[model samples]
Target: MIGKWLDIGPTTQIEPGSARTLPVFGGEEIAVFHTVRGEFYALVNKCPHKAGPLSQGIIHGDSVTCPLHNWRISLRTGEALGEDKGCTPTIPLKIDGGRIFLLREAVVA
Candidate 1:
């Protein structure tokens, strides 16, 4: 089924080169980041290494270095930067009229 877009907050809620964590329906958190290059990406906030909150991480280029262990993961593709075969899931995001929207049906693995 298709899900509707959820208004997260104003686009300014997440600045360029910064990230924000939004609460979801099932006790899960979603991390939304806007790269310094002005691209929006979303993914599950939990890191696969030690279950760290990825939203609290720092953005370096197109990758986010996990705050807990410094594990770098790609925000665009949800894949670990290096040395990992597994990856978290990415969510669908849309921006319109300076507001950020997140799709409710975020897929994870």
Candidate 2:
């Protein structure tokens, strides 16, 4: 399904090397990450392995380590890294004039 861009907030709202979880429609949440390299990524907040909170995980490079079971997931592609199986959904994001935007559609697994 086609998704519309929904403004989230200013890019400054999230500090570099940190993440924020925003509650979306259908009671699901999206994890928005600001990398130390000044890049932004969005992914489904829950880990595919054990529904761990990715937002609370440690951010290193472009991947986040799942808080529940140490599952590492890529922020760029939402794919589980190495030796791991399954993946979470990714949310397309955009930045305009220092503001962040997210697709309004529900994330698919």
Candidate 3:
């Protein structure tokens, strides 16, 4: 389950295969990605390893290759791929009426 949903902006604000980082309260940042398949995903902007900016990573399918170390991360689950270790935090997201909404609570375990 998720907590209060906050509207980020219209879906059009983020192009497919691209990402946008939004700074939230408490100095934390969230990375919102629009996949080529038109799906939206939200996760912590920082990578679990080295704290790299995931928003600048390359989007491939439902995953992103971290720019700092090429660590592939699942956009849907925020899990590190292959032999990589650790996982980033994922935020629940929903799209309605062409607008994007993010759950205020972190969905990570």
TM-score of each: 0.87, 0.92, 0.92
Looking at model 3, residue 87 earns an lDDT score of 95
Task: Give me the runs in candidate 2 sitting further than 4 Å from their true place.
Answer: 1-3, 106-109
Q: Give candidate 3 regions above 4 Å deviation.
A: 1-3, 107-109
Q: Is candidate 1 or candidate 2 better by lDDT?
A: 2
Worst lDDT run of 10 residues, candidate 1, spans 100-109
- Across 1-109, the per-residue lDDT of candidate 3 in tens digits comes to 4447788899999999999999887788899999999999999998888889999999999999999999999998999999999799898999989999987655322
Clash numbers, per candidate = 0, 0, 0
Tell me the tens digit of each residue's lDDT in model 1 across 56-105: 89999889998998999999888888886558788988888988888755
In the predicted model 3, the residue pairs found to clash are none
Candidate 2 residue-wise lDDT at 59: 95
Model 2 weakest 10-residue run by lDDT: 100-109
lDDT agreement with native, every candidate: 0.84, 0.90, 0.90
